[model samples]
Target chain A: MKANIIIRLKKNILDPQGKAVHHALSDMQFGDVEEVRIGRFVEMVFNHNNREQAEEETRKICDKLLANPIMEVYDYTIED
Target chain B: MKTAVIIFPGSNCDHDIYYAFKKVLGAQTDFIWHKESNLSSYDLVVLPGGFSYGDYLRSGAIARFSPVMKEVVKHAEKGGYVVGICNGFQILTESHLLPGALHKNVHRKFVCRDVYLRVENNRSVFTGLCREREVLSIPIAHGDGNYYCDEDTLRELEENAQILFRYSNEKGETDRRFNPNGSVANIAGVINKSGNVLGMMPHPERRVESLLKHDDGLKILKSLVNGISGN
Candidate 1:
């Protein structure tokens, strides 16, 4: 099974990198943006046929290694 | 005193720190590869700065899981001295050995310049020789050096005097303009509750050599050397 994870900075955490990108887009005449917050996307390949088990394991992985609870929150999905 | 400089794959300042320990401090120093697990032989272990693991995912995010980090944690649990500079600082935070995360600079630029740092807490073993509020000039080179922590941690850091250094003006005032990175409270360095582990974004090794004419970094190294002798 393959799993995809989205890791993002918490709403209160400052996103300087995202702000820079927003500014660049605005300079190029795409000025309709109110704000931008950057986050990370990660993929994982698990050796199992259990969709339920993979999703659970991916959450545990996010807690232990993939996401830093202090700075980020993560959500993931498992695909067949 | 025996010192070990932990050499992660992309660590470029390991040799510079080794030189400070060997030639400057006249201590027996060696490099320990990141794969090694035993860190019991050394009196001091330094995680020198560089783009460890190519700063993948995040700076120090991947390097934190290297085999040696397990030993590093054990070393810290025993109250052993560990200093992480720049990228090494990022790793320490990522490993949860330190209480914060380094985010990108507010300007989103890789800042490489000398900045003034004020010693906020000089009572720790790492800063024993330094005077509180004394400003020192140090070189900081990094893109993601803005330090952030939760509100409770910030309160505790303030109440306990755990903040080791803060970006400051030449006159030793913690002003906004002196903050090269947008770190909360303008923090440049911090020590854990035990005062055994230290992580800072400034490159102290870069200024250790006399030829560099910036000897502020030596004060920090010498303070640690002095602390070991006193202990």
Candidate 2:
């Protein structure tokens, strides 16, 4: 099975790298971009017998490693 | 005193600290590779600065899971003295041995320069030789050295006097101007709740000798040695 994990900085966290990209987009004339916060997208393929087990394992991995709870919020979806 | 300087694959400051401990501090120091699982015999364990694991997936994320880190965790839990400098500091936080997380600099740049730090609380073993309000000049080189934590943790740190260092001017003014990376409360270093582990984003080992025109780092290292050796 495969899963897509989306990791984003918490709303209150300051993301300098994300702000930098927003500025660059303005310079490129992208226009009217209110804000941009960059984050990580992880794709994982592992051995799991079923979707429930895969999702449970994915959540555990996110909590343990893929996302730092101090600065990020994460969620994932499994795909066939 | 016996000290172990942890050598992660990309660690570049292992020798600098080893030299400082051996030549300057006159302590027996060895470089412990990251794969080594035994950290029980050392009096002090140091995580030196560098791009460990090429700093992939955030600064210290990948390196924190190294085989040796488990033992390091055990060592810290046992109240063993451990100090993490620069990238080492990042690892300490990533491993949950320290309270806060190191984010990218507000300026979004990699900074490399000597910065002044006010010894905030000298009661801890790491700063025992440093006088409160004493300012030490130490070099910090990192892109993700900005420290952040929740308000509750900050309040607890202050109440417990766990803060060890704060970026400041020579006069020890801790306003935002002195904060290089915009860390919360200008914190440059902090001790664990038990006060045994220390993490800071400064390179004290780089300036341990008078030949470098600064022996301030020596003062800190000496404190570490003396703290562990009870000298």
Candidate 3:
């Protein structure tokens, strides 16, 4: 099975990197950009027998290591 | 007092911390590798600053799971003193030993300079020797030192007096302009609820010698030693 994870800072959290990129885009005349938020994307391949088991394990991975609950949120999809 | 400085891979400040404890402070100290899990015999365990795991996933994200961190957690749970500095502070947060997280600097650039820290709570095991609100000049070098936490957690920390230091001016005014990293509440350091763990971004180890222009860092180190030695 393969798990694709997207981790991002919480909506209320201030992302300085994203702000900088937004500024750069505006400077380049792409002023339609309303906002930019930088985040992490991770793909993992592991052995799993069923979709349910893969989802559970992926949740565990996100909760334990991939995303910090203090300031970030994570979502994932599993495919086999 | 005996001290152990836990050294994770890519930790550049390990020797400096060891020297601060062993040579400058005259306390017996040893370097414990990240893979070694036993920390039962040390009075103080220090996590020094540096790019642990090269700041791979996130600052201190991967290093928190090192075999030695389990023992570090055990040590702290037993009321043993644990101080995490710079990147070490990030690890402490990632390990959930301390509340909140460290975000990138507000300017999105690595900040390295001397900054003034106001002693917010001198009653801690980490800051007992300092006068309340005393301004100490310390050097901070890190890109991800901006501290963040939810409002409820911030309220709890404030109510419990867990805040140890805040970035401030020479006169000890915690104005926004003095905040080097945009940390919430200008927090430069904080202690856990149990008061046994301390996580701070400033490098007290880097400024311990008077010959280097300031020994304000000694006040913090000496306080820890004194608090532990029953002095």
Top candidate, metric TM-score: 3
TM-score of each: 0.97, 0.98, 0.99
Using TM-score as the yardstick, the better of models 2 and 3 is: 3
- Backbone clash total, candidate 2: 0
Q: Give the best candidate by lDDT.
A: 3
* Whole-model alpha-carbon lDDT for candidate 2: 0.92
What is the model-wide C-alpha lDDT for candidate 1?
0.90
Candidate 1 lDDT tens digits, B49-94: 9999898888998999999999999988898899999998999999
What tens digits encode model 3's per-residue C-alpha lDDT throughout B42-160?
Answer: 99999999999999988999999999999999999999999999999999999999999998999898999999999999999889889978999999999999999999999999999
* DockQ of candidate 2 against the true complex: 0.81
lDDT of 2 by residue, A17-58 (tens): 889999999999988998999999999997765888889899
Please write out the lDDT profile of model 1 over residues A8-44, one tens digit for every residue: 9999988887888899899988889889898999999
**Which 10-residue span in candidate 2 chain B carries the lowest summed lDDT?**
B123-132
Model 3 whole-model lDDT (C-alpha atoms): 0.95
Docking tier of model 3: it is high
lDDT of 2 by residue, B1-231 (tens): 789999998999999999999988889999899999998898789999999999887899989999999999999999888999999999999999999899899999999999999998887888789887899999999999999999999999999998999999999899999999989999999999999999999888988887898889888888888888898
Docking class of 1: medium
Poorly placed runs, candidate 1 (over 4 Å): none
